[model samples]
Target chain A: MIIYGSERVEDLSLRCDVVVVGSGAGGAAAARVLAAAGAKVVILEEGGYHTSFDFKQREREMLPMLYRDRATQRTRDRLVNVLQGRCVGGSTVVNMADCARVPRAVLEHWQRDFAVEIDTADFEAASERAEAALGVAEIAADQLNANNRKLLAGAEQLGWRRSRFHHNRTECTGCGFCLMGCAFDAKRSALVTLVPAALADGATLVSNARVERVVVRGGRAVGVQGVLTEEHGDRPAARVRLEVAADVVLLACGAVHTPLLLQASEIASASGQIGRNLSLQPQLPVLAVFSERMVSFRGIPQSAYCDEHLVFDPRVGMTGFAIEGIAGGPVQTAGLVGASGRDHKRWMARFAHTGSCLVLVPDQPAGSVAADETGRTRIDYALQPDVEQRIRDGARAAARLYLAAGAEVVVPALRPLTEIRNEADLARLDDVAVNPDATTLLSAHPQGTCRMGEDARRAVVDSRGRFHGLEGLWIADASVFPTSASTHTMIPIMAFADLAARSIAQARAARTI
Target chain B: MIPEIDRRTFLRGATGAGALLVFGGALPLGACVLAQASDPPPDLAVLSPRAWATLACFADHAIPRGGAFEAGASDVGVAGLVDGWLVGADSRLVTDLRRGLALLEWGPLLLGFAARPLTALPPESAGAYLASLTTSRLGFVRQLHAALSELCLLAFYSTRSAWRAIGYDGPIVLGLAESVELERR
Candidate 1:
């Protein structure tokens, strides 16, 4: 049964075998598995219940309706804008639908550095299950839009390594509104896939219910208490109180909110890592103006990626950078122009002729997430010296790629390097100071806040996703990643959550036996 | 965008500007200019009258009229739209935004760039002052410029009236004749 918290008149109390504290990629995936195993699961989603019909394909309406903090959540320094979904399926409902597994090198690095051991065959099986569930497949050659084709042609001309990405979209209409939300239900996000499957298996979903804190009894999580909110325009007004008692509590509130929830609940880990080790994987947008009309807003937003600069090391895991084709609506694109007055208008005037890509750089776990004195979530992340250099290199490479592909002018999203028409202009990048407020950076994948490993002294959760020092508590989100999972985190997160849920089910079955 | 100016440049030039502001006692100049009579929109939901005027002035300069597009941010009432949007935003963010707007308003006089507040300056001077903020040596000042500029640009470009100038065909789904409607939850 699905319950809209706004419609409830009085306080609600429920008892269940398992209570999933989020409805995102991990929570939905775990709920499906637990429900299929005959566990009475209750999923509490802080955001509203929205489906394809709610998607208006307009940023003005959809951004506030679908995203957390109206798509304006930023780091403490206000440098990188951290975009995450707060609606029914979390970020899965609004992501680009790119599906990638945790790179083998990254997994090995985790095993070596974080003492995390996973059965390769089991993980592969879980990944296959996740792929099958989401209908993951390679993008066809014909599906490459003009914006993406530019990246491909540039890489081919430069003899660089580039490849098409796999996506979870089926019957996509090329609406170019993937960042907002798929209105046609083309993307098989957790909203349409596991969320519905879990519901079909008798898992109850409560929407517009914000889980405030976990109720612990005798060192074990017994339940969660929160408030029901009703939508008043774009704001959610607090209303009735909600409480759910459960034998097991699974937190899947992404990396940012999960740690905040733990802090609010007064849950501490032996490793002192409850809200540490945050990896943002920040990306910079680079736009190019082509002479011909690219009409980038009409087709698929992201389809191809160039990993010529991407590197993986046995000692440090994923490093270097990646350049992927990207495009957005006018509102989002204009924000990246980094110009004022006439210069800004001149750039926006060529919106139809612009092709863009994001320079994604993998960084070490150097950031942290904590609540401030005002109880507001604070994400502290600053680009390290190496990461900053990688971003500059990636930006220059992306500019050259666009120039090689017949762009008239390449515009890095930074104020200092506004226009790069030739190799000479690229020299200007060498002297650019890459600090906060100098450019626009975004983070769609935030991981490693409550990282998982074997040793209780260094990890917040065990490899099986159980809390190290607590009973009946588990984490199934990107928060459990010991390092950056991959360029995209959907498939890896789902695979990990699937394994964690199976372990929980096995335990439940053994106890009953 | 303006050329990049790092902190060293600002620090190198700060002595002169600091002396002019400190010894010249130019801080009250902005207050005197702001004290002049002005009318503000009555239907504003969140921003104060002074903040609304400051934001309106900043938006006009950030996206002035008679440029690539005939309709600028002020023409589309971008500041009013922002005020309405801020109604639903976090209190901390709203407070920060108001402070940023206040800084922009009093920046020219306090920084010794002009004798008048931003709202009292001519359009070209206001535009130049706002552009200077983008290249300011102070990180927070540059951030203020970026935050306000982005907010204005977002609000302006999202309007349907600005679509033709940008060569965008708005949302394709809205134009479809027979759109498939999903079952509403």
Candidate 2:
């Protein structure tokens, strides 16, 4: 049963076998599996409950509704955005639904560096199950929009190895509104699939209930307590104190928020890594204006990716990056073009002819997230040198691709090369810096904040997703990733979440907790 | 001193460092807006007419009157849209914006003109002034330019006026996917 916590007359004090905080890719998957395993479960989501029908393709209308802080949650310097969903489905509602498995290299990094025990084959098996559950499949050749086609053609012409991405949707109508909360419910996010399935199996869900702190006693978690506010409004008329006690408290809040909650609860990691090692998948969109109408917004937003330039060699402290097709409605597009008034107006004047590709640079864990005394999530993140270098390389490649794709003018993320019309202009990209003032930057993926590993000293949780030295306290989200995935994070997060649930369920069957 | 506007903290892309916090953080929104917090707006609807006109003149120059575009920022009520967005914004931020505009009004005084409202300036003068602020070595002027530029661009394009200017036909409406597929068929 789904209940709006604020509507209740009295304080809410509930008991359950398991209580999962957050309902994104990780939490929803765990909620479904744990509840199916016959554990009476309750899920508390900080954001409101909204199904597919609730989505409006309008950026202004939808951003403030579905995203945390209206998709404006920025780091300390306000250069990088820690974008994630805050609703019942979490970021799965707002993301582009790119389902990438944990690559072999990333997994090996975890195994070798963090002592993560999962072998490649078992991880792949888990990934297959996750994909099956998520309805992950490749886009048909017919679904390729003009924008994606141009991007693909450019990569092929350059002899770059590009591949089509697998998305969770069964049939996409190509409205290009995935970022605005999938209006058609076609994007089978956790909201439409696992969350609903979990609700059907007798799991109770209370929305707009923010978990303040893990109620701990003698170094073990007992319950969680926080206030419930109005769903549609920021200011609560009368806040209701909502509390839930359970055998397991699984925090699946994303990297930006999970650590904030942990810090608020005084659950400091032994290694002092509670809010450290934040991984931001720094993404910058490089736009190209074509002579013909591409109308990039008519189809799936991101379907093709080019890893030809994504070079990662951990031994030498270099993780490469890739570029993918990106679509933006008016508001988002205006922001991506840069800070110039004339340049912005000029670009939008020919908007229909614009095709854009986003460069995804895999940044290492060089940031942190914490909650201050006011219970507000505070993030301090800055990209390191290697990540910046990768972006420079990627931007140059992106400019060439656009030029190759018959673009009349290419707008690389670099400020000076605002309008690159030819291959000669591409060389100017080398001087481009990764500073936000120099480029229009964004980040869709936030990982490794509350990283998992075996040693309690170096990580927040054990490999079983159990918080180190804290019984019945676990985390199932991207917060548990030991390293950056270097790709879209939905599937890997789901697979790991499912694996964590299986481990927890098996342990519970043996009365382990 | 930064007055920390975490609640509904909206940063514009064109206005500041691409990702630098103009509020609380390592860079505490220019070491506290206290330095410029002298004159404050009087109403809950904070912008005064002079302030409104200042943005108006600046907006016109930002987009300028030209090209294939049917409407500019002023026609699209961009200044008003931005005003509405700043309704509940932190007073310090609004004050900073107000000071930024006021400086431009009198900034020409630095260039040997009497202190007059920015709205009184010609389009060429206003455009030159804005560009001067953008290229200014002063951190204060650069930050103000960043905020104003982002706000104008975002608010302008966000309006229905800039939709056709950019080839965006507005919201795709229902059955957008199905209709596209059917059209293909």
Candidate 3:
């Protein structure tokens, strides 16, 4: 059994029944399935195993320790700096524990439009298994943090329906460090859940390995070739290239990079639709200040959202949007507030009591992910006209809701406001030109980079995740998501991975017979 | 139908052929692996001394002792902390942190002027110097002071002490049993 941090094996040509790359939710799910089915599985992860004990609260140290690109990989085109985990648990280690089921409509759309024939019954069954495996459940009302309560208060004042959101947490100690890698071994990340289960069921995990290319022969994936990168304290690190033959190769590198891999392989020749139609359902945050100590810091990170205007209804498209409650520390708040000198001091002073809510808009699938001249990712996306208007309208609604909840000031991302001292000040937001260029837009759901469809010319992979016309090659991450769903994408991606693993297992059994 | 499938098949072949070309052309042993450097361990302390000083001053400002400014600005192993933080490992923010510290000389200048080390200066003088640096337009002093202040606040708030100072009731200590069990795991 290969636990994390094992010394290098001298030999290069190692064989395995299956090889899963990237130990995120999706990859981990697939690894567990294959290992449990009594297959020799070798899971290669680029990041090392990180435990809660190693979770430093400091961003300067922790960012490099846990996150990819050291948390400095900014969207050069947009005013957003994305952060994703690079450790054994992947993003799950640092993600706020919000587990929402895939919206039924999204599944229906997948079936009707995309030739993926997963019905409501199949989806429900898959979701049930995934939820059970993940220990997913709702947060009780009594467990609602001060931040969540304020969001509820605002929702109540606005006469909007609200309820506690579910999470994958088993016994959350109410630690504010969920978004910054939980220090207490409370949040159930893949590092704790699927990876461990997979290991226990006889899986071989090789950390510090980077897969460069998947070798294919006669339209079949033969194996993979990559380097194992290790950092020696001061000596200029070590790199050893690896060549492994496997029966099946699962690509779970993630949306942003999977397309790069495929493009590197020059595999999208049929229609060259390999890395197209990237959707980063961009989100903008709005902070509301209250006189009373909201203490928005201590709670589940994001537990609710205003769905009042959420539907196929175009009127609600950008009309109004606000989440349960979004909170962070003073430095993070200062970065967002973008004020210097005494005004910044004032913002920091009220940081303890400041209530924050993010307004997210489902960007109408308009972005493109392409490699630059230097072959690095160049994510270029412009807000559509309707999307820009929706942001302004949504921001205004958030301001009104805050004021209704007795907030003294509403600091919107793109509005000019001295402070909302009275209810009449809400009207000023209408004229506040919410500049899409200037306003902060972050993306958690990066999907459709490697889309699945009926036509091989249109999609990189088929409905079952197999690379189109290729044997023993499949993608099992957010890259396989044909389109972005309304809510979070982690659970849905993991479900799809589980389904893909089942298909691979059935194929393997059939071949053996 | 044949062309479409052939295109897909040909694409797969091209991918395989590309990998084969790279593998075939490369000098297997000496080329792929980068040459390892055998340089002496840097006086890790030498590179980041200025950054350490700035961070030390900043930490002092944020968590000074007593009610008074000079009297209260406290000091711990902040220099050592910053030094450790700078050289410990690879991080995006702190990659050239020591290099960035050269831009802020307020901490070093104050350290030079103090009756004792800036870490050991009387709380009153420390407070006064901090205030002057913030308020005065002494170009280098102001710039360095501002930088130190910013760096310190970030460092302090990010540490366990910030949580303690703010009365945040998050986890602080690990239980003995848990530590032992972790060792086993």
Candidate 4:
């Protein structure tokens, strides 16, 4: 049964076999598996329960409704805007629906550098299950919108490696509003898949319930306690208290939040690695104006990517960058124009002819998440020197790609309106400072905050996602990734969560026996 | 060893001191002391009167009327919309924004563009001052400019009135006749 905590006037108490905090890709997947295994699971989601019907496809309305901190959550320095969903399905509900597995090199890096061991066959099986459940398939050739086609064409002209992305969307109406929620329900997010399956299997979901802390007794997590908040808005009013007693407590709040919850619960690791090693995988938007009307916002926003520049090292995993086709509504697009008054309006006037792509760069874990003096979450991330160079190189490469694709002018979202008319003008980017606020950078994939490994001195959770030195406490989200999972993290997160859930279920069965 | 002053002179000095204190306290209350002509929105929720006036002026300059579009941020009440959005935002963020707006208003003086505030400058001069902020040597100043610029652009373009000029057809979901397909597990 699904309960709207906002409607409750009295305090609530419940007992369950498993209490999962968060209802995103990981929490929902784990909840489904545990529920199917006959564990009485109770899922507590801090955000409200919203479905496709509630999606208005308007940026102003949907942003505040579906996103955390109204989609304004930024790093401590305000250099990177970290966008994560705060509604029922977490980020999976608002993501671009790109599905990818953890690259082999990344897995190897985890095993080599982090001592994180995973059975290859088991992981593959879990990934296969997730893909099948989500109806993951390659984007059909006809489904490539003008923006994506431009990306593919550019890569082809430059003889760069490119491919159509596999997505979890089916019967998509080509509405270009995926960054907002998908009103058509075509994107098979965790909200429509695992969350519903878990609920159908007798898992109880409480919406608008924020889990503040885990209740630990005798070195084991016994329950979780928090408050039930109002249904909507960035700062919802706390209405009532909520407590859930469970044999196992699973935290799947995204990388930034899961670590905060652990720290608030006083569950410090011996390694002091609770909120270290944050990887933002920041992406920069590059716009190209074409002669013809591309009408880029009519179809799927992101369907193809160019991986020619993406590099993978045996030691460090994924590095370098990948360029993916992207478009947004007028409001989001205007924010990237980097001009004011007439100049800005002139750019937006040609909105139909503008094609955009994001330069996705994978970086080493070089950030941390902590609470400030005022008790607000503070994500501290500054671009390292190498990452900044890579970003600049990536931007130049993207501009070259657009120029190769016959774009009239290529514009990287930078201040002072740095425009690349021809290949010679690409050098202008070198003079541009890639410092904070000098360019627009956004992070949709934030991982590795509370990383997983074998050593208690280095990792917050073990290989099986069990919190080190703590019994009955587990983590099953992107927070457990030892490094950057991939360019896209939905599928990898789900697969890892599936494996973690099975481990938890087996442990419970073993204890019962 | 004290020298005695005239009683009339002492009374005058005390009265003048009281007047200075009263005027000094009231000066800050006139929120937009530099731009006394502008007023805050009627439905203010979070922003103070000075912040509201500064933001409104910034919005006007950032997305002024009569360029490629007829509707500007001021025409769509972008500042008012942002004020409403800030109502539920984090208190710290709200405080930072208030300070940022104040800085923007007084930026003209600090940047040596003019002795007056941003709102007091002519439309062209105000636009130039805002442009100068984008390339400012100070990172926080540039950040403030970028923040307000983005907020104004987002708020302005989000309105339906700004759609036609940009060639957007708005959302298509509301007009769909067919039902969306659902695949159950």
Candidate 5:
């Protein structure tokens, strides 16, 4: 049953075998799997169950509905725009829906140092299942916009081995509206995929219930204490502390907020690694305008990626990053290309023919997440010299690709002064200060905040996803990923959540006697 | 502080140009509004006239006219939108934009000039002057262009033009075929 908001929490009315804190990719997946295994499940989601129909493209309204701080949640420095979905489906609802397995090297890293056994074959098998379940399929090339086609052609010309990405969507009409919440319900976010399935199987869901802290006694998790706010708003009409004693408590509140729950509970402090090793798949976009109408926003938000450079040797850090096709209208295009009034006017005029491409660079694991002075979570990442250099390299490469495909002008995320008309202009970015504040950096994929490792003293959770100090408490989100994968993290997140559920089910069966 | 947009021109973009054009057309006037009307047009009491004119021209350039585009920049009350956004609330962008606009040359003159009641000028004159600006002539024009570009890009990227430009085939427009698909699917 779906509970919209606080019903003046009757004392201990909620009881379940597992109580999942979040309802995102991990939480929703975990709930679906656990409930299917005949374990009564009650999932608590901080955001509302605002389906696609309820979504409006407006950021102000959608932020409160779909994002954490009305989607404006920023780091303490007030830079480094961090976006996360806050609805029943979590970021899954707002994600680009490009699913890729946890890279083999990332798994190997986990297994070698953490003694976690996520063999390549195991993840491959899990990925297959996830793909089938989520209806993941390549968006047909013919369905791509002219801009997407140009991008693909550019990558092909460079012989970079880029492949078209398949989204979980079955019905996509090429609307550039994925970022604002899909209006067609075609994007297979967890709200439509897992949560619906979980709901049908008799799983209980409570929306607008923000879990404040984990209830612990005798050094073990008992239940969680959370306040149920009024349905859509945050005014505390009535405060009810919820405590549901359960056999298992799964923390899937994602990387940023998950550690705060553990920190608030005063758990996982012995290792002091609760909120460390912040991984931001920091992305940079370069927009190109062609004389012909390419219209960047039409095709899938991210339809293709180049993984030709994904490697783990000493010289190269991680594999090459994925590239996404992006575009917007006059207002948006003007911002990127329109710095001078003339430039702004020209860019707006050419908005219909502009194509945007983004290089999804995986920043080296140099940054970390820490709670701020107000006890609110904050992520601080100083781009390593190499990472910034890599971004510059990627920008130059992307500009070349766009220019090769007849792009009139290329706008790199560097300085507005740095506009690329041909290959010659791309070199100027090498000297431009590509620092964190100077460039527009966005991170949708956050992993390794509450990372898992072999030792209890060094890692927050065990390889099997069990919290080091607490029994029956496990993390099944990207938080458990010891390292960031080379590709998109959604598929790997699903596989890990599935594996965690299977482990819990096995443990329960073993104790049946 | 930046100047105010001509209220007459701003209103044209708000309603005359069509509802969709309002987003980009009115994005720039917000940095520092200097409405001279009793108590400064609600939110915009700080901006001078020249800042408003720059904002007006900036909004005009952003959501441009011609090619049968019914909504001109002035249709959206682009000036009013800027005023509303600046004085109505406090945000990072609002604060930054205020500081940024204050840095412009002749900023005080523009702010003071904004207080006078605005009269609609010939559209051709507005267009010609806007067309004359170059990266070399006025750095402020370049700066305005950049800020306007960012604002329009944000609006365009987030608004309906993006969806239309991208060829979105969502179910919002329920045609006969769409209804059939909705029922059949």
Candidate 6:
């Protein structure tokens, strides 16, 4: 049931009961559920289908194959790099496997603000089902890597709200290569689990097929049209033009592409929210080199977390953010630590001893994703002043936590601060310019591009992920999230995707399709 | 054998690991090698020899030579990386990069500094010139520096020699054995 576009010979004309336009957590999960319900499913992925066996564990090699545009996605100002998986598994394949539940507070806010109609019990049940489906498990204390242990110790020393992280892995080995696509098949990404299960249930998956636009007729979505980038292998020789027809069309092309596809397809949102209200969890990494070896890249990339900064009170808005551990491969480490040059080299030389944590800001929907004249995705995003100030505060907090754990020198600022030896230098973070243009703010979780709500005036989809005007069209990805959730988005998005897919299945069962 | 990725611990980069893509665009070493094979890399997709020299000079100045850092910019062939990056990029970006490098090369003489090419200038002179562009009153000049420096830095640091100088122990997994191998990904 898995078809490689590289090997495809000629034009394609396929039909299915459900045609999903992505193969990430949401799309794969939906395919599995819909296929299990006896609905013929077909999933189309723009990127090549790669798994652990093909993971060479080299950044330059893997990135181009696994990530979209080789992970060079840029915000309008080119300040932040938006990294999302482009392969068959979508973002889940490259994600750090940090799974978190939907905070009741966020659900309550959604119900109150967007009027999304899901009760607490139903939401919890949906989440529970997803967790079980994905084989979500807890990280044991014995398996804590040195990098993770340091953050845990630091958080404990600082009295931060620290806890273990849950991940979707069967027998993970702490190899710390999740961001590079797990080499041992330990991460249990959708490629290994949901996609396979769906395939087992007779689902068809087409790889390297970039859907140019959704084919609409008489205001009803009938199928998708796209081009096959390769006849085989990893070459960019556009070959076959693909045409896929389906009873139901699901847009799960992540936050960025889903909205862009909608616009390109000329699907009217009526709510003016096709690509509006782009919510993001922006990152500011605070690095500190310890006297002892941390070797932050040795084990699980994201083993420990501190949610203490998630200072949320629907009344006052989300004030604080999360601080977690992260270290990249050598290339990523060298490229991101500082601006070009000697000091940047100095930071890399100390890579082994450096312990890094990011201050994550749960941001408002303060941006838009637009395609340029060439049809490339560009995010027009800016950090609000208050969020910038909070990030500054969180950077200091993370630095202090490292200092509390006895880091020798803390490099908190992206463009080399004077080196923090004590609280005095840490306080200077307030003096540093908080310009989003200059900051090394990276957005990890992007949601709400085509948000779901009750009102068509402000939302793109309904509670069940149905498009406002189209009957057989739906979205089951993070694009439909109304607000940014306060944790890793994998579980919440899958849970919601499962919910959305269930609705589609019900419609088919009732012959509504 | 590669030790298993432990699912037991609470690993984190708590601030959702920054959303942005790290480093420059797809850095396929194949393309980089092919691009550099040309002399001064003429028929260059992005930079001419003089312009390539400007980038080398700027990257060398940025990292400089001293301390434990032994390799300079051209030693690792950053121009090649830059060329490959530009070949796949929009012509506008490649043109912008050319324009910026051209300014760095010729801007010195026009602005009444020493008449030496930027590549041949002393570190202090080169440093001062780059600093001027970085802090230039014209925001355009500053923006140009940002674009130019990013590619230079990424290309320079991407070198194995540079990584060695920085004491980075290469990739995390050297290779996985056959026992636990799955079907080709």
Best by DockQ: 1
**Residue pairs with clashing backbones, model 4:** none
Say what the interface RMSD of candidate 1 is: 5.7
| lDDT agreement with native, every candidate | 0.84, 0.75, 0.63, 0.84, 0.64, 0.74
Q: How far is A91's C-alpha from truth in model 2 (Å)?
A: 0.8
Q: Model 1: clashing residue pairs?
A: none
Model 5 residue runs over 4 Å out of place are A6-13, A58-61, A76-79, A231-240, A314-317, A328-342, B1-185
- Model 5's CAPRI class is incorrect
Backbone clashes in each candidate structure, one number apiece?
Answer: 0, 13, 10, 0, 55, 40
- For residues A352-440, write the lDDT of model 6, one tens digit per residue: 78878778888888888988775557788887887888888888888888888888888764654447778888877876765522555
Report the C-alpha lDDT of model 2 over A131-177, residue by residue, as the tens digit.
Answer: 88888889877888898899899999899999888899976888888
Q: After superposition, how far is residue A89 of candidate 5 from its true place, in Å?
A: 0.9
- Alpha carbon deviation, residue A204, candidate 5 (Å): 0.5
The TM-score, computed over Cα atoms with residue i paired to residue i, of candidate 1 is 0.92
lDDT of 3 by residue, A18-91 (tens): 88888987888889888888878888877767788777554655665676654544454434445566778788
Candidate 3 structure, TM-score to reference: 0.76
Taking the candidates in order, what DockQ does each have? 0.35, 0.25, 0.06, 0.30, 0.11, 0.19
> Which regions of candidate 4 are displaced past 4 Å?
B1-40, B107-115, B175-185
Q: What is the i-RMS of every prediction?
A: 5.7, 5.4, 14.0, 15.6, 8.4, 9.2
DockQ of 5: 0.11
Which regions of candidate 6 fall more than 4 Å away from where they truly are? Answer: A231-237, B1-51, B84-100, B107-123, B172-185
Candidate 6 DockQ category? incorrect
| Model 1 chain A worst lDDT run, 10 consecutive residues | A229-238
lDDT of 4: 0.84
Question: Cα lDDT for residue A252, model 3?
Answer: 86
- Residue A170's lDDT within candidate 6 is 70
Evaluated on CA atoms against the true complex, candidate 4 attains a DockQ of 0.30
Q: Model 1 over residues A1-513: C-alpha lDDT tens digits?
A: 999998889999999999999998999999999999999999999888998877888887788788888888788777688899988999999999999998888888888889887887888899999999999999998998999999999999899999999999999999899988899999999999999999999999999999999999998998899998986434477899999999999999999999999999999999999889999999989999999999998777899999998899777789999999999999999888877788788888899999999999998888999987766677889789998999889989998999989999998888754699998888877767676667858899999999999999999999979999889999999999998885799888899899999999999999931
